[model samples]
Target: MARKISAPSLFQLGYYWEAKIFLTSVKLDLYTPLAKGPKTAKNLAGLIEADTDALTRLLDALVSIGLLRREGDAYANIPELAEFLAKTSRFYMGELMLLQDAEWDHWGKLEDIIKTGKPTVQDNIFMNTPELGATVSKVLHRMAKRVAPALAEKIDLSDYKTLIDVGGGGGAFTIAFCQRYPHIKASLFDLPQTLKVAQENIAQAQLNHRIELIEGNFNTGPLPGTYDVVFASDILHYQTEAENAALVKRLYDATEPGGFIIIKDMFIDDDENEPGWNAVFSIHMMVYSEKGRCFQGKKIRDWMTQAGFDNIVEIEKNTILAGTKGV
Candidate 1:
């Protein structure tokens, strides 16, 4: 059963005051200057060109939220957060925050989108801004490095000879798989611009000779070569169910005899209302995408069955849908 919310909790849920405060600070870049040393609100206002009186309240609010620390006359970024929040920090995640800031405007139209069933933005961030897409690709690569290793650990790829990562961004999973299994030669296929990031990442990993980078759109593709394993991760959410079904059929067709078809995505349960994150993400898609939304695991299971797959199984419940081609 789901937990019931109290009055205060419900109020807090409706209140986005603190979220806006943090995103606003990210936009202001207040952490960068504070990383050098603490500053009074007046000093910060002068640096970022914010109004002194208004900036003081925001800084105090940041302190209350534990993002900032205030003492005597100055405020500073919390030590742990400064590592990622500060613009000058090597581990900075300001880009991701900036991305949320960009979406802030779109999310405001959630009501209108719900009523009209129209997307707020014409194109996703990648299509509208190539430069930002490249930076986000790098950020995502760094994050996926932490996750792909675990996923690699889950799936046994020791016997798989050739693998294609359909819509693989920046070669994160491909790199992890190649590193885990020495005999595996892989293909990293994605859009032309996204593949540039993949090329740089593959070269850095020194697997350039082993992993061939293919530049094309997966939606309009005759993917090159049959493979022992065809893995699609985090790409299905961008397209419609029919599109994804067609994609799955294509992947199944491209699979070698006795090969595996793996699809990894944030999937909802049959109800599509139980998983909170995916439920919210459904609305996110409604606001941002023309034909994107979270799907049920059953949808993939049906697609797999329809595509003439055998030995179908969801290896990670809703997160990973896997099936084997009959020998």
Candidate 2:
């Protein structure tokens, strides 16, 4: 008898249904209301102003998907959903989910992008819309908060006094570092409109007095000032290889002697293949940016070495790189 191979992987291709269900639930503000307590589908429909029959089915789907729990006719959020999906939770991910909902339009044109090698939507749409920018900034800030404590623990910043966050959209990492080391004052550099969002976040973190906001484009102009530490997260993938090399050189010159420059972004293998998530993100960069793509860790290391940085260290499974400036 011949061995048989299964094709259950084909079902993964239809995973968009799961995404749509979750996005729809978020758009309906379902989880937030459920955060209050369990409610029957009919009661939830009345509260969220939806048709009871339709909502019942949707609620059942949510329960099946493990985003919500069902007891008889009552539907309630699971613990994970209650914490991260509920709008009342500080870690709410609804804004990012909503942004992904908007990106569905661009993702729908993947075929056009593949054929023409051109983006169907404007790349700077977020920057052009204040509301969208703020939403994205808030989401990014929350994400940074989630990762910052572990990151701060990994890297020693005791000796560092001043820091600059290049293209630091909402000052999440800045606030985190400052909170971890109360003696460290930081500067956040970003676009004027982006800085507005960062200012609000920084003020909320109560680091307004410690974190100064600098409004400018690092690509077009010089960085604000020299610092003991320079950090850039999720920003380098927006530039070309040559541009990144140039930017690294500029950052090198701006780094104080014996200081550190840290970069955190999704990086692909040297072959630019494998790591399914990074490969998909490379495609996303192709559609969203003219010159951006997921760069290789080796190339980033080369850039840092060429810029006179030594003691380069790869951390977080190569998602982050830190280089030391020689004294």
Candidate 3:
């Protein structure tokens, strides 16, 4: 008989063992079967090509982990996991799992990384080659495209004529916005190699006519002052606190008076203990970046105030931070 394992010690390890199981299920496309409706054990086994007995246990394990729900003789996808984990869902977060999987290999080297304080990206299989990075960037763009349009609804973006996506990987955000607001022209700022994928995504979205592509590192170069709204999503976590302040200042200068700067990223709670997701992401950043991690909204508000942006507002809880430059 196999000895039963206990829940991972929260203080000893940052990640729970169940996270590993969930990600494995995601990789195997196990969530897709239940996206449409619940499935019987035999049906799910056929879909996954696994033994029915093993598959039943697998489904039960998933349910225990809160990613799936089993009612009587039927098993169904949990709504949150169904929407985000299933590849068929529009808001699918499979790419986020890809990102996580890329980092998973490096978890073995966590001790070394902790002692050396260096990124394991190059050594890991997921980020070793430029081509792989580009591929991951494209996947990330698809994820962003799914997320941005939903945000456009509540915000008043009518006055803005141009949207500049800074470090905009894959240009999905720009594609979504341009498609929704036909009058708004879009510009994507990224390295040439990365922008190539963005160009392809734009063509896929059929927004090529309304978008312009610019190639350069925004960190080393001065931001051009023509855009009405400057946006950064899931990019700033790569920079240090001082770099974030400088970048915000640059965006403040680049925007015309009355224009807005929008930042979309995971925000830590004020006390830094809430939002378990944000806290876990901070650990992930420690593995990927030397100095960056999930930032607090208070810090973002302070950055806006210091950068001369007025009317700073936390845009709901979508991890969006927005502020307008003085008119």
* Model 2 misplaced regions, further than 4 Å: 1-6, 271-273, 288-291
Model 1 residue 56 distance off true place after TM-score fit, in angstroms? 1.5
Q: Which residue pairs in candidate 3 collide?
A: none
Q: What digit string (tens of lDDT, one per residue) describes model 3 on residues 71-114?
A: 77989888876888888987777766766776687677879987
Q: What lDDT does each candidate get?
A: 0.87, 0.84, 0.78
Question: Judged by TM-score relative to the true structure, which candidate is superior, 1 or 2?
Answer: 1
Query: Of the pair 1 and 3, which is ahead by lDDT?
Result: 1
Candidate 2 structure quality by residue, lDDT tens digits, 1-327: 222335874565656798898999998989888888889998888998999999999888888888898877698889776788888998888887887787777788889889997766554534556678767887888788888878887888999999999989888888888998899999998877778889988888888889999887787756878999999898888778888999999889889999999999888865533454676788877765565688888889999999999999897665999999989
Candidate No. with top TM-score: 1
Candidate 2: pairs in clash: none
Between candidates 2 and 3, which one is better according to TM-score? 2
Q: lDDT tens string, model 1, 149-200?
A: 8898899998899999998888999999999988999998887778899999
Off by over 4 Å in 3: 1-98, 111-129, 273-276
- Judged by whole-model lDDT over C-alpha atoms, candidate 2 comes out at 0.84
How big is the RMSD of model 2? 3.5
